[model samples]
Target: MLQGWGIWALGGVQRIGRAHIFLAHVLLGLPGLLLRLRLLVREMYVVGVLSMLLIAISGLFVGMVLALQGHNVLSEFDAEQSLGVLVAASLVRELGPVVTALLFSGRAGSALTAEIGLMKATEQLSGMEMMAVDPIKRVVAPRFFAGLLSMPLLAALFSMVGVLGGYFVGVGLLGVDEGAFWAQMQAKIDFEEDIINGIIKSLVFGLIVTWIAVFEGYDAVPTAEGVSRATTRSVVYSAFAVLGSDFVLTALMLRGE
Candidate 1:
């Protein structure tokens, strides 16, 4: 049993090493993505623009829920007026990056994997390769960069909308002091420590999610069933990667502070 466990651990490490190598190749090809600016823009429109509505709605609702729940708890402690600080800190520090990443993994990341998988199934990628065109440069790289570029902005918007939602529920509905809420939030939330680190977290999550999406699609077996399976794996893997990385990043960032 101990030997079996050792072998399993070794296999996992080998897989991680191979994944790192794959990521290096993909990243090294990123300069070519700039040459395919038109493709990148199109991907941005599809992955970023189309995803905004869902992100906005989710952000707003999440904030409202947090405010509602936070109020109930804080009321018992006679600290309901601190609702803004609670909402802002929670959204900006943790929820914004993590939730936005999960949503992006489901929405844009899955879509990316599906589209690429379908292209592979249809032999589009192969045809490009046979024609002496590098599909990774022309196809995958643009989508990868588009996801990376969109993520921080999406997370920022989500945080902003969440703050508004919190205000609407806490101040407008619950009649907490609006001035105190905003003031406490401003006093507690630091620009560099909280906001910037959150953006960094989003950026990292975006890279991990999109990397899994594009790589899974690219490596999928060239069959309809394979495409379907790849798409599912992309979402599942991206979610796990995002959550796992979040814990590590949070620990490192907090230790730095």
Candidate 2:
């Protein structure tokens, strides 16, 4: 169904399957999210630590580009001062969550699939089922909550980087006044809304990554070939889901605004 002629079929199947997985993620994440605060904390550390180099490296370039792009466009209008607000808004609402989600999808999503697929190959899940432990709650649930907790942390980190990128580009490179950057940021921004939007987007993205990974792993066939197929599918589907959801959320948010 991945072929061009089967695109519609693939979309429909993916949508239905994704919806089921999404619902599972939310329901699973709620109790797990509340009860697994300790795991959440640890997962935060792992995600933040694992992603720090990425967040910083990506963020630095992101910030530089945001400012560079803003300068080019706003300069045409002679409204260079809008750079700060533009960067702030763009990072908070859009780039922050989208970029973080893609990164998380690549890093965490593939890892989750491989780990679970390995477990399946080793019969760990069958063993768990035989032992009467709920595999979903015991295994998938923690990771689910972990993704939920990690999304905002990652997004916030990216936004910070993006904002700093703007700062360096605006002030250090462009010679914009420092106070003016902050002042413009404060003047045009609605922190509550932007923050909430960022969180909401992250939450959905977290759910998407976790669900795709788990589904692919659980469905993996036997032998190394099956594992490889599952891994490839995990990355492909997770990336597609992230981009599709980002577009959907952006459209919905824009329509509301």
Candidate 3:
């Protein structure tokens, strides 16, 4: 049992080292990414545009639920007027980036791992190597850059749509005072503090999710089962990383306050 534990520990450390080296390679390829602008745009469409519908729908329902629950809770204190502030703050600061990243990981991140893993299984990467074409630069970098670019934009959209959904439920359905809703939200929410912090969180989550996805794919054993396992690992690992990092980041941000 002790030997097994030691082997597992060593394997984990080695995997982490390989991931860091993979990240370095991806970063080193960034300069050449601009020359392959078309590839980046295509990946942006694949990961970003395709994922928007899921993000928007999830945001809408999440906002509605938040407003409903918040209304019920605040009404106990006779403070239903603060519903807008509650919804906006919750979505902007916490839910927006975190939920969107989780969804992105399940959706686009898995796709990335499977796609790249299959490429490796099919010997495409090996073919590129034989042709003196760097597959990391030609393939992985664009997808990585796309995830970084798409995540914050998607998070912003989720927050905006969620706020609107809250308005729809709070003001239209629950008879919340529209003036109080928008007014309190405007008054209480700080752009730099809430919004900027959310953006930063989304960017960090983007980096984590994309990095894990690409590395898993690149490291996958060249077989169908390996690709499937890699895809599963990408989602599972991304979730753990996002949630753990979120706690750390929230603590740091609160301290800064």
Candidate 4:
């Protein structure tokens, strides 16, 4: 049992080391990305634009549900008018970034892992080496930067659409005072405290998800089964990382408050 534990621990350490090295190689390619703006734009389209519908639809339903539930609870306290603040604050401060990251992981992140893993499996990545081209720069870095840049924007869009959905439910359907709802939300939501912190969280989550996805692909065994496993690991690992980091980030952000 002890020997088995030792082996597991050593394997974990080695994986971590490889991830760090992979991250370094990916970062080294970032400066050159500016010169190849087309690559970045193409990836942004794949990772961001393609994912918007999912984010927007999810945000809408989530906000509608929150409005319905919050109205029930707040009504007991005679605070139904505060429904807007509740939905806005909940979505903007927490759900916006967290949920967006989770969705991105399942959608774009998994796709990235599968795509890269297949490249490796088919020896396409190896082919780049034959031409003296850096696969990390030519392939991995654009997607990495695209995911990073797209995350915050997607989070913001989620929050915005969510707020609109909440408005539809709270004001149009539930008959919470329209003016009061918007007023309370505006009065309570701070630009720097709520919005900026949420953006930061999304950025961190983006970095984590994209890093794991690319690394898993790059390190995958060059076989069909290996690529499949790597894609699955990408989603699972990204989800865990996003949740864990969210708790730490939330604690730190709320410490002052």
lDDT of 3 by residue, 1-257 (tens): 99999999999999999999999999888889988798999999999999999999999999999999999999999998999999999999999999999999999999999999999999999999999999999899999999999999999999999999999999999999999999999999998889999999999999999999999999999999999999999999999999999999999998999
State residue 47's C-alpha deviation in candidate 1, in Å.
0.7
List the candidates ranked by TM-score, beginning with the highest: 3, 4, 1, 2
Candidate 2 Cα misplacement greater than 4 A, ranges: 1-48
| Candidates 1 and 3, the one with greater TM-score | 3
CA-lDDT, candidates in order: 0.92, 0.80, 0.96, 0.96
RMSD of each: 2.0, 3.4, 0.7, 0.8
Tens-place lDDT digits, model 1, residues 1-257: 99999999998788678767767777877778777688889999999999999999999999999999999999999998899999999999999999999999899999999999889889999999999988887788888899999999999999999999999999999999989999999998999999999999999999999999988888778898998898999999998999999999999999999
The segments of candidate 4 whose C-alpha lies over 4 angstroms from its true place after superposition are: none
Clashes of each: 0, 1, 0, 0
Can you rank all candidates by lDDT, best first?
Answer: 3, 4, 1, 2
TM-score of each candidate structure, all chains considered together:
0.94, 0.85, 0.99, 0.98
Candidate 2: residue 56 Cα off by (Å): 2.9
User: Over the full model, what C-alpha lDDT does candidate 4 score relative to the true structure?
Assistant: 0.96
lDDT per residue as tens, model 2, 30-74: 675576677666655655568767876787788889899998999
Query: What local lDDT score does residue 90 receive in model 2, on the 0 to 100 scale?
Result: 89
Candidate 2 TM-score, true structure as reference: 0.85
lDDT (tens digit, per residue) of candidate 4 on 1-257: 99999999999999999999989999999899999899999999999999999999999999999999999999999999899999999999999999999999999999999999999999999999999999999999999999999999999999999999999999999999999999999999999999999999999999999999999999999999999999999999999999999999999999967
Alpha-carbon runs more than 4 Å astray in model 3: none
